[model samples]
Structures are given as structure tokens and as C-alpha cells.
Target: MARGEELYITVPSMFRCPISLDVMKSPVSLSTGVTYDRSSIQQWLDSGHDTCPATNQPLLSKDYVPNLTLHRLINTWSHSSAASSSMHPLPPEITSGEIRQLVSGISRRPDAAGVDELEKIVRFASYCEENRRFIANLHDSIEVILRILIRDNERVEFLESAVRLLDLILLENGVRERIQRLIFKSDHEKCFDSFLSILKNGKLSSKVQSTRILELIASTNDSRQRTIGEKIEATLPVLVHLMRTETDKHLMEAILSCLISLSTSRSIKVQLVHLKLVPILSRILSDPETASPTAERAIKTLHLLSTVAEGRTAIAEDSGCAVAVLDKLMKVQRKAKEEGVALLWSMCCGHGDARVRERVGKENGVTKMLVVMQSEGDDRIVRRMCGDLVKVLRGIAMAESSSSYGQGGLGSLETKTTHIKPY
Candidate 1:
């Protein structure tokens, strides 16, 4: 056992539970003569197993007797203060019976009782990582919690406690894999629906958890990504609403990440633009207080949005949005610069908006920024994009100048040549 910086003690292997692999607080002996933690052996027995877990031998009797000798030794050894000045205090021990009782209560009762059980589970799990692992390892724990989320979703208090508990236990790999499996199953439609409901109506923390859970599922693989993308019509609006109403930076970041992951299909992209995702993202980028990481994600999502015609058109039509994209050219992050260049290139060149090109060139001074970025030795691709943007802007300038001269608006039409080296 190790606690803090001042204490270290190697717990004897015999004092650990074979099933949980944690220190045994209550040791018991099965019929096969192997001593185990009372809670671990009791859980095994309650699960309807008749054989010894360690030896897999037929049990002469299913009942286990307490091994008082081992318990006493563990108690004495654990209380020794001579080994170190200070040891990390252990959290209050929770028995397997208590876990089973709570889980059973949650499954059988779907009222205030269920909510109370969930709160108890959350409190116990929150006490320490060991308790979390213990509860997560118990069969049907995560399933029961998910069922509560799906069944009692209309109950705000129940949903809040259940979602909070789910978030806490989601740190376990087994729990996450189980959630992924449930999400992929065809019959589990209500499971995903429950998350959407939470996003729309639950408290802010619950909404954040639901968004993060969806983000995790969406990021797993192509199949999961496609599954989530299919729900874009239902999911996108709620996310946009949250982004518009919520000021919490963390939640905003989560929503942005979820957006980036789910914006995979062309139809989805079109819907995102229609849902005003472009302007929401634009507003995020326009804020001076947005963190660097959040800014990068917002830019990346906008870049994705810019892939479609509607997205590009919206961006080009909003001059503040256009200026924001241009401003990214001066950011210190290489990725921001790269994505910013690509986004602008798409809006100006891909969209073929002469006004945007002129505005970016004449008003935003993108020409000077691009020139400096190139001169400072950016990567080859960024330099190439910079070159392309410069050429496009210069072409637009010449076209406008020639148009003015042909209309007889200017006093003199003088041609000047300036050379820029190719990237």
C-alpha cells in the first residue's frame, strides 16, 4: 500500500481478495479451504454459483464461515503507525451486499427510492477510485443505471442523479464498452433518445455529460460515427440551442467536439448550416475570451462546414465571419494558421465571392499576413495555400482596377508590376 509521499507498505498477498484483488476487510473461508473476502465470496454465492472461485472445485456447502484469525491479523497490520509518519486515509469500506442492495433497489423501484439508491451509489463511488472499480465490476450495475436513464428520463431529479453516476463510472473501460454495445443494438433506440432528451431539458451538468458521452461514442470508429451521424436531424438542433444559451466554456467545448465528430455527411452538413451552426461557430471565434483549444476546435468545425456550398456561402455573406476567418492567419498555433488558410481559401476561391476576396485583401490585410507567414518559413502546404490565396486576391484586385479604368472612373490607368517568389 502506498499513500501520499511519506508512506509505503507492501500488503501481503493473502490479505487481498482473490475476486476484487483489493485488501480484504472481512476474510472468510469457503468449503474448499480457500479464504476470500466475505463480500467477494458472498457476491459469488448470491449470483447463484455453487463452486469455489479460486479452485473451481465442487463445494461441499455453499455457505462460507468467517476467518476471524486472518481478519484480526489484517486489522493489526493496517493500524500500524510505526511504519510511516502519515498514510493516506482509506475511504469508508462498502460491502458487496450494500452494492447489490442498491443495484437491486434501482432496478426494481423506479421512483424516489430508485433516485435515493442512485445517490447512495454515486456518493460511495465518489469517495474513491477503489469503490468505483468495485461497483463498476459488479454485474448489471452500469446496465441498471442506463435503464434508469431510459425509463425515468422524464423525472428530472432521477435523470440528474443517474446521469451523474454514469459519468463517474464511465472512467472504467468495461463500462464504456458496455455503453458502446448498447448504443449499437437496434432495440436500444430509447437509450439514445434518452440522451437527446437530457440534452434538451436536463440541467447544465447533465447536458454536458450527455454531450460528452455522445462524443465518446461518436469517436470510437467509422461504424459508430455513421450510427451517430444518422441521428443528426434530432441531435443537431439541441446542440445548437445549448451552444446559443449556455455560457459555460467547458460545455461549449464539448458541444463543439460533438459537432465536429457528427458532421460527417453532406446532408448533415447542410442541416448544420441551416440550423445556424455557422453563425454560432462564427460567434465563438469572434469572442476574444475563447480559449486557444476551444478556438482551434471552432475553427476546425467551421472548416468542415466550409466544405459544402451552403456553408461557404453563409461564411462569405457574413463579413464579420469572413474577418474572423482572416484573423486566424495571425494566430500563433500552426494548426490554426493552416486551417484558417484552408477555410479562407475555400470561402474566397472555392465560393468565388469577389466581394469576400476584395474585403479580405483590402480591408483585412491578409496579403501582408500571408506574405509574412510565407517569409517566416511555414510548412510547404500552408505556404502553397498562402501562395494560392495571394494570387487569387491579386487577380481580384487587377480585375477591379481594370473594370474601374474601363468605366472611365479613375483619372489615370497606370500598370504596376510587383514580383512574388513562388512557394
Candidate 2:
């Protein structure tokens, strides 16, 4: 008999994952192949934890020798049962004693864990990633976990790690939106007392609590389809509040990312600009004395302002969206540079109506384009766009010059101030 065989066995019975109380399958191996999960099991065996579950005897991860004998017995027993069941009439219900024994057997397995409690937990996490409906409402699980962590017990330190793991669980469809609404009261005013209390006193880390706030206010459920106007109307207040008071970049980043979703609709774009968010943003980006890392992020938010066609037209009408962008263009590279060039191109090329060109000319837009064109931003696209702007400027200049040099040669002062009406 093996010396340490007793230690290898489950104290009272068999074992299982709290999740998927069934025997674990496709045990994932980590990079070291030591830990197990679905994705990396084979790698785990390759890294080598060879030992039989029964006797602690040397066994490969793939085929621990003990299971072979167990498998043969199960196959023979199953074959005999099948033959008997096929040939005989069905039996009556089992006696109470037999039922109790069956129930007892299932309960005793370490894997059973009093029922599939751990299995279901693990399974739901699996469902989130698979987009399967494992749980009736998985976001509820996130909330439950948060509230548990908020009590500031042993799990407080693990709150962030739990969230990251939940993110890996990816609830698709409008699950994101559903959960957001679920967390809040139907009447926003009604729930403020409770939510604010948590905000003020919860022991969950700031990042975690802040994450919940952003999730409720700004994050989209995978299944939602809100126009920018809808999102602005729905979340603008919460976002505005956070923008005023929250400084954590990640929480701010989540809010900003949600705001980016609003940049798609012209109605939403005009409304936000009209609300005066632009000036606040501009101050953030160009505050030389108060420059911060987020200044670079504020620079990137230029994309949101420039993306809307109507918004660009509004900029031409003096929204300051363009000026804000041109300011950022001074410090562009990688993605920031890419967005600047694209926004500039949109401002110049995507606009309709000659009034935009007239406005551009009036705003010293020629000088701005000329400077960008002269600098390293001289990508062929920028140069061509600048060339176009200059043509507009030159055309305006030429028209003035021609009026000054009227048909009467040098022209009289009164006649030189001529008006040429369009036909």
C-alpha cells in the first residue's frame, strides 16, 4: 500500500470545481502550465504536475494511470445496466432508503460542495464570455459582489481583481444597459439618498466604486442602440457631475469613452457644444501653467468635437471646436497626430457651402492651414488640403485686386470700392 495514499484522497469523497461541479475538463494551463483553466490545460501538463489523484503516484496530466482502471470498471457496469434495462420492463420508484443513499452519495463528493454552488458560479463566468444565458441576470452578480465587498470585510482588497475577472466575463447584447438600469432606481431622484450614501462611505476602493458609477451612468450595454442625443439626455447630468468632481483618470476615462459614443450623432454633438463643454475641455488642454497628463487626453477629445458634420459647421459658425483642435495639432503624434490630421481634413474638406470657406478665410484659417502644411504635418493629404484652402484665400484676394484695377485703368476711389453681384 502507498505510504501517503490517505493524503491524496478527498477527506470524505470525490472533488469538483465550485463551478461546473462535473469533473473539470480541459484543465487550462498557465504560461508555466502549472495552473489550470480552459485555455491553458495542455500547457499545464507540459509544464508537469504529474501525479495520480488516488495515490499520488507519478502520472501525466493527460493520462494519470489510475483513471484507466476506474474507466474500465465504469464501462463494464454501464454495459451491464444497459443490457438489463433493454431486456426488462421498467421498474417502480426506488424505496426511501435507496433514494437517501443516492442523495447522500452525490452530497459527499468534494466537487458537489453541497450542490453545484461553485459550479454555477464558475459556469456563469463562463457564460458571460461565451454569450450564453447561463444566469438569468449576470449583472446582478456583479452588484452582489460589489455590495459584499463594500461591507469592507476580508474581500475588500480583492474588489478590483474581481472586477477585472468580471470584465473577462463579457455580457453581450444589452446586458450592459440592463444592468445599469437595474442598479439605479426608475426615478433618479428617489434613489439618490441610498446611492449617495454608498458613494460617501463604501469601503470598496475608489476605482471600484467609481467604476460602478461610470457603469451605471455612461457605459453601454452591448445590446443598446442609443443615438448621441439619447445618451446625452440620459447621462449628461451624471457625466457633468463626475467631470466636475472626479479626477481619477481611469474613471474619467470611462466617462470620456462613453462620451465618445455620443460624438456619432449630430444632434448630440450640437447639444454638448451648446452646453459649453467645449470651453471647459479647451481650458483643460491648453492650460500651460496647469498642464497635466490628462491634457494629452483632452487633446484627443478633439476628435469628438470635429467628427460631427453639423458640429463642424457650428465650429465654422464660431463653436471654437476648430480652434481647440488646431491648438492640439501643435503637439500631435501616433494616434493623436492621426486624429488631428483627420479632424483638420474634415474641417476643410467635409464641409459644404462656400460660407465655410468664407468663414475659414475670415478666421485667418489660411494662416493656420499654411503653418500646419509648412510643418512636419506635411503629409500629402495635409498639403493638398492646405493647397485647397490657399486657393480659396487667393481667389478672394484676386477678386479684391481685380475690383481695384477696374476697366478704367487705375480707377477712381469711389469706383474701386465696387460691388460685383452674382448673376
Q: lDDT winner among the candidates? A: 1
Q: Clash number for every model?
A: 0, 18
Q: Score each candidate by Cα lDDT.
A: 0.70, 0.43
TM-score between model 2 and native: 0.41
Per-residue lDDT tens digits of candidate 1, residues 1-423? 355556556778888898757677568899899999765576456433566767767687988888889877877776677322333234445565887877877667644355556777877875545677888888878778777766733677667777777876776658878887776666454667778877877887788778877776766677565665556468888899889889887688778888877777788789989988888888888888876556777888888888988988888777778777676556425555578778877777666687678777654243554554555484777667676777777655555555655534222322111344437
The whole-model C-alpha lDDT of candidate 1 against the native structure comes to 0.70
CA lDDT, candidate 2, residue 421: 13
Tell me how far candidate 1 lies from the true structure as C-alpha RMSD in angstroms. 15.9
Off by over 4 Å in 1: 1-97, 104-113, 222-232, 371-378, 395-422
lDDT of 2 by residue, 343-408 (tens): 555666665445545544445454555566666443676567555655555454444445666534
TM-score list, all predictions: 0.68, 0.41
